[model samples]
Target chain A: MSQANEFWVVAEYKDGELQEVTLEMLGEARKLADKAGSLVGAVLMGEGVAALADPLAHYGADRVLLLDDALLAQYTTDAYTTALAELIQEQAPSLVLIGATANGKDLAPRLAARLRAGLATNCMTIKLGEGGALQMTRLDYGAQFQRTMVCSSTGTQLATIQPGVIGVGKPDTTRQAELTTVEVKLDPNKIRTKALGYLKPDPEKIDLTEADIIVSGGRGAGGPDRWPAIEELAAALGAAVGGSRVAMDLGLIPWKRMIGISGKSVAPKLYVAAGISGASHHTGGIRGAKLVIAINNDPAAPIFQSADLKVVADLREVLPATAKRLRDMAVSDEQGGQQ
Target chain B: MRIVVCAKHVLDTSIPFEIDEESKGLVEDGLVYILNPADRCAVEEAVRLKERQGSGEVIVMTLGPAPAQEVLRECLTLGADRALHLLDRAFDDSDAYSTGFALAHAIEPLECDLIFCGSQSLDEGCSQVGAVIAESLDLPQVSAVTQLELGATQGSVSLQRKLDRGGREVIECSLPAVLTIEAGINEPRYPSLPMFMEALHKEIQVVDLDALGVRSQEVGRRGALTKHIGLGPIRPRTKITYTPESDIDPIEALRLMMSGQTAPSGQQSGDILKGEPDYLAQQIIRFLQQNGMTPEANV
Candidate 1:
């Protein structure tokens, strides 16, 4: 059996703050490093990003490779691909893992092409296989099935793991590791692209992907004017609010809040869909939820077919009542516990 | 100002897909094909550009089987002035690199100032075609364009490109440049009655490798460098284990319920707030006041 020398996890940072997926990848990488009897290295690239090394070390990285440069400050495909390619060529880790975010999706394919390596993307789970190979599982056919793949090539085995798919264990603050800062040479002229300014959406708005619970409204919610009930329910539960593409097309919600094949994929603990007809396009987004509850005025709505719980009633009448009931139950439970 | 919009026919993403046993690829048994949504957007943008210019012509082109004309008709319905279909048996199973090569060769004979294509096809999601076509034809290419403005007198076009960081860059390039339109770049217009009727009689000029003066060996699957080796099924194993709270009483039925091995049964009871309209109205008003909201602010 071939033993891997070093295991590497590409730590993603935005605005000098490490993203949650980076810590999640490090947790998985540490497990693989233990099995291979090798040290785990975390690769951090960006300007003023060296400060993230200590946190990475706390989260199972034995050493952090810091690539600090002005060009690296913003995520341009050219600069990232160039820096990652150079680091892989020099350090030559046995396995590399990245987050399957938008930035990672664009960066991974380009890096794989440049490095001449095979990559499995949007992985839900990854583990060390026999003969020091990496086994990865990702959704295929629009989240219909989970496809497992293994990278057996000699070069770096790359896998882009999806966020919230794996458990991110608590960091071990006691463990301190070495931090090595490296500078990458970048040519500004070769970068055909430039970063214009970022348009940040409202941070107060819930990100559908990270929400533990989601309350979605559909066409049956009457119209765009009736979204307040949906938002109220979502706010009461501290859940993200989502809408069907039909709702988005009708201008009830922004395009970013649409959930379906063309929109964001979500995996929440509880998904409460109100007035949804459950079109296959919209169902794709809620397939990952642990529990699905559907409420619709039509008794024959397709949503009830896949729902774990179904309430055949008018959403206009039922949603407000349901939210009130849940809120009262919560308050009563708090009072009972105190007594 | 002749504009060429390159389109691709892709499997409808709204349906379920199975893997073919023979080729180890997606099975298209019950699949319906459509002009890739982004490419439809591209065709719409090109048609809009032509309408703005009034004298320019917009042509839609695609490389696929003879049946691919259905997709070309869609472009015509969306408002392309003409259609060019490059169909042949040899082009089957071709990768992006070879497809780009064939497209560049086909357009070599046509007089075109600007070329547009979908940023990426949904099936492959490669996003390499526009760049590869640019490299093959030696033309400047901008990808993931969200906005476009053509300057006829200046012989240049300015565009807004979607970058990785949730931002857009405005770039100006000379004419004869290729642009790949991103999804959500524009709302593609549906076919009108007149356009739909006209598209039926519109002739789609079919070109093959022989007619284009290109050797058959220089195109199609044979010219492709990358090949699919094998496909594997994706399976995820979910292990659910539940632990009980330490302070909880250890009764047999309660312990079993807490294990969570079996799914929960029915909904638990909740506070039932029932009353007539007057009582309900008063309760609602009280709740709103407690929440620091007034009746006037309810709307």
Candidate 2:
């Protein structure tokens, strides 16, 4: 293995498939490597998962450092951190990027502590700055403000990238990477945390990030009892439903339904903001939206300032009424076509 | 059973906060600082667990400036038995890794049976401190717990943790472990007026790096692995406002909406529209049809 500090990305995989973020991180690392005159390496750990390296290579990795061991088959905080930290120490990596998922959130900090490295959490952008320093930007104070952070020139620089922030380049089947197996010496006694089992949530839960059209309710959205109208409008538009941070904190909606900097980031072709004041935290996540429509009783709501459409009316009345109009239009269109 | 809860005094995220240009940190003037909302849940959970046993001590700890003493007192008023403030300028400019290191060092001597921390700080939202502390202390960490129940058997606990896509992981762990409580798990109870008044008089134990047996160079700016290089605003986005904020008829509003649509440039944003839901509904349907949003738009 080359002794130079390589631009490294730890691949996240599940259910015998590589997660999309892994490819996205590799793609990003490829760009950074090209600029800094460095090599890109991907650390993929699992049992009998060497085949997955092909996809990582196809995405961006120049070499795949495979750590295949039964101890790592299931993710326990202890085993994964120990194995990766050992490899990172020996390989002398300059920077490490991880996806900001649940496991990532749990793993990144421990590794940082073990390695005594710097960690920038939930970064939306990454770039190498002056003096060959790794500079990253993230929305903070609930995404209302943006700040750029720099990692030290000393030890390994570490960061966790938010999902969907980095673009995944088109894969080239012709691309290939060198696969090198790294031995994982894990003692079963050191593993204290055990996975009891996963309890699946409702199968019908919608992923707000991937929705083409999204209808979100916010501060003015009274409660679950008042949510039906919003739901009705979403159904009429065939869009996924979401709620704002205030709605989720008030227990009017589930946490996963929250649409804000603290929650999920979404980019839909059409977005309808119902009873929302459009605070920067909520608006920050929707920057990628193509078209925005705002509905509120108060015409002075901040949402109207940037929305494509503005409504100065009560959402409770407008939502269901709009849904009814949509259905009626569809029905009448069918009749008009027959004529 | 003895339980220790880690709390933070952070800027109230409900209000707007500005960054200090010189220090590259928060400008602390005119801003209300409260115990982190998420940490409040952890403190509440610790108090409730103590109350259930009818006999246990809840100790709250924090690593921050002297003003952080107030947060420890707040925890006390909320029913905690003791408070410890890890105060030192030597700990400044510490990131999640260094911050957790100092906290773990302070907590090691307490020899508590359980440790509680908020899943993430409201201001930073790193979601790493509790896990980092666990790692430093060589204990198992269960994070972002929504539902927690202490078993009748000593040293046994059950929890439901948040997973990706709204799923949950059922976890069963033993005592002497670290748990990061999720927000909205349980309603945090406010202290009574008398309790609040009493908390003011209670003494807050202040400890520095020397007291914690950690060297100054290990946690201060000198020891930090991450540094702030730049501060700036986000990418500028376009903004337009509707004038004469009067409620208009549904058809006119729909016309305005269509006119203002995501035009390339130079086109005006539509007028503000307000009308009865019944009438607005009709106009919206027509608008969708014209915009190709309805099912039969292609036709």
Candidate 3:
């Protein structure tokens, strides 16, 4: 058994449910906690968040500390950090794991600075090494190299893990955990910026991070044309649609849907590359995909090197045909089920 | 108003990198260095802000070895009014946290109203320094800022921050805040020949760890929160099996092509079919039929 007795995972809730990354963190945290002989604690902060303790427990949390208040209905840096840092100081867990979301990124650094703790950001893999030290692997230099970091022994080890990189454990309905409410006093004066509101993109489109499969187009797709061919394949496969930097730069796709070092890093179950040359920049984003299938006219495209399946054909013709085949396959599966 | 922009000189990434056997880091000898791409955007934003004000100075500040002076020089040529280099051997092993601590100390005494930094360094992509510095200096920070609007007269700045999942957040913060600029915010103007020549002779003020009032113990490996335990190439994807286009029926060939499963062992590359388009399409259909995936397969 390890010397540390506590492991903490910060829970993030949005749109009235626990974010996917929170569950993933709990899943990984449970393993590390078992290794260290430590109890896994979930720190949930937000208004009306006490009810989230059950889901966290189902994901393997042994205890839940909820800091629910009206002031925290929306995330403001000062309030959340103050409450969280205070709880961390009190609990003094050996390690804290946070999801590398926008709010999580902003909060982790501020909390680390306030607590003077060592922080590893954007870690893809984490393990508890000998002597209870947290070992973390993260991508650096624009995904050119992976660096493994070991936290110092002096203070609490903190890390922000990227979303979609880690797998979530199956929920256990019979799991039980203790929930405690902690009161926090937030000074409204400390909040320098008020979240006036939020602006969203087209809601009909699936989020890249949440999608299991992705169909990405590049400059080779020849000017987007609303990316109908790519969309057809995505619709057929039930995958999200994405684009490369060139396609995004040309205003053919939204910049937020870009897959590369600078944009969102996604790890889908299956990735379809259409008309992309597979430059290191674009390929790096697809590194975590379980399987890659490339469709490009250029046989020399670098993307072919990384793909498990290659179709060297013009996407305009191949995409429509492929989509039809997949649709037909689905129909046959239904018919077989009926028989 | 004085705007301070943080710049970094990084090894050019387009060229292949060779690791130094002795240090386990990039080999410095014979390697080309350039201003980090995103830092160039930060400099551009600072220069644009200076030009808009028409009276303020934009100072470029950086922390690195002597070779990094080239980055500061480039900023000068690009229209910065002055340069500051925090140079010290002790910082060679510093991580993002310690570096930010030293930088915050260095900038605390300077007269500044706003600070800008590239959201990340291309060499490390840690993205911790700017936020850490902001925390140390007790200032609000907004990162990944793509659109910036400065209300100079109102002592506030409103900006649009990019999100990874497809949206933007509009945030407004008071002046004297830190903003980490992302790429593509503005097209960086190229330095003209005359401007380049004029900036060649400008002096960059150099300060060491002691001069900046930062103790040597507070930097380098000793002060670092995290230590690099290992560095190596990223693991490549699993090998693929290639099927030759001429060996089988086109439909059968295409079915095997669409399947993402690994091919028989010992096949390093996948099949390459060089055939007529009509034939290839038929092969795909045949493969689908063999797999019982087509409606006809049910018959």
Candidate 4:
């Protein structure tokens, strides 16, 4: 178990850049590493990954495990899992955390199975338990209940942290890390899946996950007919528009725009819930927000309880006015600067 | 072509759930159970493929108690030709690893050309069962498939997988492969009237650990390498403090909401002209044009 004391984080890369979630994981891993009396390390695998080691070090990784190879460049389940499994056995980190992205979700389980370790997925928080074990708490039964889990056996404790759930810590830009290069042996016959091509989504599309402010509408927003006012407010705030599961279920918005446990998890600085009843299932998605404000006619709505500020007013009356006022304020500010 | 669709009955994710006091787990009381959303998508994809090929049989299989028949019935109603219910009291407490072993055993006798399952069940969302099942059977598997199309040959299929970093990848695999369907693969079809009635009377073959020659010691809670130690409530504190009133009435309310100290600032403020669709549309169109954009043609 002494080998397990070191903290390891898997860094995910996209378009020659480190994904934000990778930084978030490193930020959390730094805390765990400090508590475990060890150093934080990262497993960097992919094409052109050597450039990522410096940024990882800047983000507080004491060491970077670099697996650089063309076969390792593109993510294939068989290839990635085989390589990671071998690394786990060799390094034997006490705690391994992966971002609960699509790749992480796919890879974590296979690695856990190979190591015969316990896994907790989509965890909200992770900390060192008594005796230096990992304690993980995740929303269960659709965010209605929370379950705390720990690895009962020896070896590595594995968890996939949900994106936008943890805070991105301050990176120490002056830190230096040791980059250890390793070779992963791959069997051609074992590689059954092959990547044919990559498709990129349209850049103009709004990704709420990256939005600094989100304007979400619910059933009380009436219908698709009322979306213009909501869009106006979103435009005024330079925010992304989101919808509750009820709105998505009722076809008010596309399911991709739904924000909840089944959908995307977002952690914008400001979150505005309009016409939303504030169901626990839905609130779980926004709990990571720096601030939450709820607007609904029913003052007794459950969402108000979770909100930092509540407006007992109709959304139809308030949204456009707020948009106009914010616009006016922006214009005045610009004019004053010119004067 | 023979297709095997693995399904699991899970608590509907849309509703609030409680933990059962007796079981020390999720409370099933008043909770509606349905075919896991991902699994439904998988079954629907298989049904569509079979329909396209014009000659294939879809078999639905689940490992749970009799109540899980409801999930199998859902698949049958959606056009599965037959169903297999791997029912046994002993299988109740199986973890992902044990579940994988049991499923692999059950799938061995069927000799399926393709096995499909949801990417992950909503309850545990472990996202490992399909891959583990593939490992147990020593077959190739792909997870989180957003799109699937049959290739030039009968035994090959092309797939588009949802990648973690906001992109998709196209992959090709031969037949006798396992594929887990992601959400938004295709809209799952509703059960037809006649199929629903027929599903009620269908004789779903029940298999046990012994029937599949799986040792009792290899499954259930005992075989599970991990167990639940405790559960906790996630309670985030919400403290509200109103701003001091020093402004006029109209802007005062707005100021109160945006003060940051009192309320989180993004809550929906209603459109000023409430309940007037044409007026709202006119306002929206004007706003768009003012911003050098035209209203969407359809809208």
Please tell me which predicted candidate would have the highest TM-score against the true structure: 3
Candidates sorted on TM-score, descending: 3, 2, 4, 1
Clashing pairs in 1: A146-B234, A147-B234
Give residue A168's error in model 1 in angstroms: 2.6
Query: What are the per-model DockQ values?
Result: 0.12, 0.30, 0.24, 0.24
Give the distance in Å from residue A194's predicted Cα in candidate 3 to where it truly belongs. Answer: 2.0
User: Candidate 2 — which residues are off by over 4 angstroms?
Assistant: A203-339, B151-154, B236-299
For model 2, the interface Cα RMSD in angstroms equals 8.2
RMSD of each: 9.5, 9.8, 9.6, 9.2
Candidate 4 Cα outliers beyond 4 Å, as residue runs:
A1-4, A203-339, B13-16, B20-23, B164-166, B236-299
Candidates sorted on DockQ, descending = 2, 4, 3, 1
TM-score of each: 0.63, 0.73, 0.74, 0.73
In model 3, how large is the Cα lDDT of residue A3? 27
TM-score of 1: 0.63
* Model 3: per-residue Cα lDDT over A209-264, one tens digit each: 65566889998785545378888877776667898998888776798899988777
Predicted structure 3: clash tally: 12
lDDT of 2 by residue, A1-339 (tens): 554658999999877678867877888889898998888999999899999999999988999999999999878778999999999999888889999887888889888878877888898778888878888887777766777888763768888988766655677789999999998899988887667788654423557876767888987886765678888888777778887888887776788878888998887767889888989888888877766778888888888866767778888888887888777777898799899
Better of 2 and 3 by DockQ: 2
